[model samples]
Every structure is written in C-alpha cells, then in structure tokens.
Target: MPSLDTAKAYYEYFNQKNWDGMISLLHPEVRHEPNQGEPRIGLELFKAFMQHMDESYEETLTDMVFFTEPNDERVAVEFVVNGIYKKAEEGLPAAHNQKYVLPAAAFLGFTDGKISRITTYYNLPLWIKLVSE
Candidate 1:
C-alpha cells in the first residue's frame, strides 16, 4: 500500500470525479453512514451512490478544506463540499436544479489500507434550499 497523501491525491481524485478510483480505495465490506438514517453498505451501494452523484451534480469540489486524523487503523476527514447542483438524485425532491454549495464531512475507518467504514455529515436544509431555488 502507498502512503496516502491526504490533501493532494485524495481531493484531486475527488475533484476529478474519479468515482472508480475513489471506490478502489475502499474495502469490500465498506459501509457508509451519512447520518442517523439508513446506512449504505458494500460495493453495490457505493456504486449506487456514485451513480447518483454522476446523475445529480455537474460540478466539482470548490472552496474545499480538509482536516484529517489518521492512525494505523483509520482516517477521519471533515471538509466543506461547495459546488453547484446541476442535477438531482432519486428519493430527493426536485430541488437540485439550482446552484448551491454545501458543507459535508466524511469519517473513514481503515483496515489493511482500505476504508472499511465511513460516516458522512452534511446540512440537509442547506442542500434542500439550494436545490429548491
């Protein structure tokens, strides 16, 4: 495994919208919990999330800053994902038509150089307002 460069490679990959590359960095049994709601687990769900992103946004991370804490087992990153919403994902109201930048955070737990778990945080009201506008 390579020594992960927190700000450079990671965000660069993200800003480029390289979902496959992003997914490749995750563990097979990875789980992503964005909040207290349902949790998305495994590669299948992860792919679905990527698909949603592809269909929903026509932009990249802007005004982004990262704060990471990594040890032998995990890496926690909190960031502000500022971007315009050019598309909408399913199950979400038709509010993603306008431009809005939202802040989000992801806390990742790693094992064997792969992300085994991830928890994401974001402001739903801000997102909703942006999309609805």
Candidate 2:
C-alpha cells in the first residue's frame, strides 16, 4: 500500500479503537512527534502512548481530507477530533465527560509501505477552553 492508503487505515483503525490495527501499519522504528513535544521512537513506545491515550479519551476523527506529494513519501491529513474527556490528563482540567471538537492534522512519513513517522498538530488552548466550559 502507498502512504495515502496507510494513512487512511491509520485513522480508520483509530476511530474503531483497534490499536493493533493501527500498529500493523507502522514501521518497527516508527517516530511519533506529538504537537509541542519530544519525538518518541519505536513501536513499543507508540503502544504505550496509545494505551495512555485510550485510558483518557474517547475520540473520532471527522471531516478528513488527505494530501500527498508526487513521490508519495509523505502525506498530510486534516480532520476534526470529536472527543470526550473520559479521564484526567496531566495539566488538564478534571474530567467530567467533557466533550470537545478540535481541528487537527498530521504529517506522515512512510518507509516500505508502513508509516515510519508521524507529527501531529492541534490547538491545545481551544481544547482546554471547550472542555473547561
């Protein structure tokens, strides 16, 4: 599969909460760059991050639009994260099932038909305000 297909599957699996499915599309030494954070490398670290995320939030990606370069080595996707804060995360408000809509995007890098890197972006303050209200 090309980078675009892998990216579509990644978000599909995420919305379905299929962590293993998401992992299957990743390279063994995948690098994850969360918005405003240090890059995390390797599948194991990715799994741990996913587990932590799963425990805290219930989210679905909506209004998705994907873009790619001619060589298909990279892909960028835009979407909205419709989510409910299920539990508390560090430096965030107490969770009372607060719902938030966050517009987000990701840049994907592929290696051998798998995603080797992912850098994601979203508005943190908007999320905080929406959920806090």
Write one digit per residue (lDDT tens) for candidate 2, span 12-89: 999999999999999999999999778999999999999999999999999999999999999999999999999997
Clashing pairs in 1: 95-131
Judging by TM-score against the true structure, name the best candidate: 2
Candidate 1 per-residue C-alpha lDDT over 1-133 given as tens digits, one digit per residue, 9 for 90 to 100 = 6324533455577888887778878789889887657999898998897787677776566555545455546555666666666665567666435766777776667666777787878888777776776
**Cα TM-score of candidate 1:** 0.78
lDDT of 1: 0.69
Candidate 2 wrongly placed segments (more than 4 Å) = none
Instruction: Rate residue 1 of model 2 by lDDT.
Output: 85
